[model samples]
Target: MTLIPKSHPRAKSLLIREKLVSGFDNGLVAKEGLLAQGRGEAFDYLLGEKTNQAAKRAIKAAAAQLLQAQKPVISVNGNVAALCPKEIIRLSKQIKAKLEVNLFYTNEKRKQAIIKTLKKNGVKEILGTNSANSTKLPGIDSARRIVDKDGIFAADVVVVPLEDGDRTMALRNAGKTVITFDLNPLSRTSQTANITIVDNVTRAIELLISESKKLTKRNEKSLEKIISDFDNKKNLTENVIQIKNNLTRRARVA
Candidate 1:
């Protein structure tokens, strides 16, 4: 006799649960990934689902990069849409970045449904490319050619949330600034991003919007300084070391 049956009302969430379990089983998500997600969830809860200092800095740099762009593009995937739909639309408007829907799940009907959902939430322009989108950027294993009608290819900056490693590396190789939101600091996406926020999308986007609003027009130099000082590898290394030290200290105390 089980206290909680498999067919309980909570079973409805099984869809997302199964996806997470599968990701873990397949090595797409690791133990560290789960820990990161837990931290992000806590941050999200504490900030009222808003952003924080580190997240704000990352977002400001991202907005500045896009504002300085000749043609900015916001790469949208399913996770981004599900996590931060309204914020995505808001960020696009603030930076004038075009929305390009790129997903690993290559279902036409589902893609259309996502687009429709975004439009309903006030996203005016959403571009979906064919399954053959390819880039010269090394390590980018995109299933479709990323269509950049706004000349995203020519832009100096791209904001890619929950991005694939291959695309991030390729974008960097193309001489474009890539700002990304990733939970796992060790992941390829984090390693390749110019400014990688080790925070969840919900918190990251809100913080970015707030920072962008407070920024004046003549802060390009300051923004550039922020970008220049951001060391992705260093930050990630520091985070890992700190967590390990804390764990060790706790063990000794125990």
Candidate 2:
């Protein structure tokens, strides 16, 4: 007898999609986010739904950066908010970071829905609703370019999970330390980030929160050392090698 009915790859993938649909119905995820999740699911299926070793190191580094941040802000887009709203809130509380709702596709109702969803997840204060004080991220033409005045604008460190390329690049250019959770090592978001965890956002976020909790007791010197020691290029290369190795093994098994 099967312990988990969706244990098979095909079935399990479908189940993940179902959860996104559930999030969508509950106003936790936007329509564009639903489509983005579908694309991410396809990529996850290819990587065997496992977090690689390099990604693990990256997660720890990301946590260190968060712990050291004097003014850290977690950028909550549709995909991240839907996938791990509660976890995001927990992380914010843990690191004492601000939770800001920043989306590529923005609208009044969707922003309200996201805020409502976050509140339902027990978040008391959510930022990014006031577009009256807006700042633009250069080179990104979408609504994602628009950041709240007091949110991402003033942050020393920003955690942008599952982000698009242009925003990541723009943020980096503006001199803010960026931490990203992108699956593909080759993606611009991963490459541009100060620290990139090339793992599933859900898994990476939880690990980041866990690491941050332990790192909270550590001093700024230690945390900064973690960031200083990290080499994004080297890590990205290792992730690429891991992907190649996994593909080869999968082909052999087939």
Candidate 3:
């Protein structure tokens, strides 16, 4: 990792880039993952690189949904494994959700590398690595369709950070509630998710863990109410409006 001064304006972004570079070098992140991160970063810049009110609302809903779910699973890919393995492990443990490794660019070596990263961060068990128990998700042709029978296959709710649109739709078709972290509100993954946190995953994930902890004390009815009140389409519209407002503010300054 490069030594980035905290005083640097782009220190956090620089650090994230370094992590991905390290991940790729270590065989944990695919080359495509680097490109995806850049795309998300562009949207993050548009949103001012902070967690907004709409994202907070979606986070709260996601936490509630996770708590209420009988079987919740956090789907991990190379980018998620590289960027926030520790946080992902913590959130999975916090909600008692199973952790599953699913990738669009599937390969045995990269899967093992991701599993290794998670294990280093104190993950006990990970699914979706074994082909024997793997099952295909309907409505998607991507490699992400392969899911563990006991993990994503049986899960009622799934947390997919930095997900693709096709799998998001497929999961919904499979009768699962999908919670996703996406910076671009207009993206297919964002629009298709049941609860879309239109914010940077690195930032929103910690908040999701915290919110999950708080929501655990609430009764089942309370948790259900939170999920019911949330409207994903409306939430996405709010995020788009936020971006427009941000652009307008920036134009005024110019």
* Candidate 1, superposed: residue stretches over 4 Å from native: 1-56, 129-139, 149-151, 249-254
Span of 10 residues, lowest total lDDT, candidate 2: 1-10
Candidate 2, 98-189: lDDT as tens digits: 98998777777778888988998898888888768788777778888888778788899999988888999889988899998877778888
The lDDT-based order of candidates, best leading, equals 3, 2, 1
TM-score of 2: 0.91
The Cα RMSD of model 1 versus the native structure comes to 7.0
Q: What is the C-alpha lDDT of each candidate?
A: 0.64, 0.82, 0.94
Q: Candidate 3, after superposition: displacement of residue 82 in Å? A: 0.6
Clashes (backbone N, CA, C under 3 Å), per candidate, total 7, 0, 0
Error of 2 at 167 (Å): 0.7
Model 3 scores worst on lDDT over the 10 consecutive residues at 121-130
lDDT of 3 by residue, 173-221 (tens): 9999999999999999998889999999999999999999999899999
Candidate 3: TM-score?
Answer: 0.98
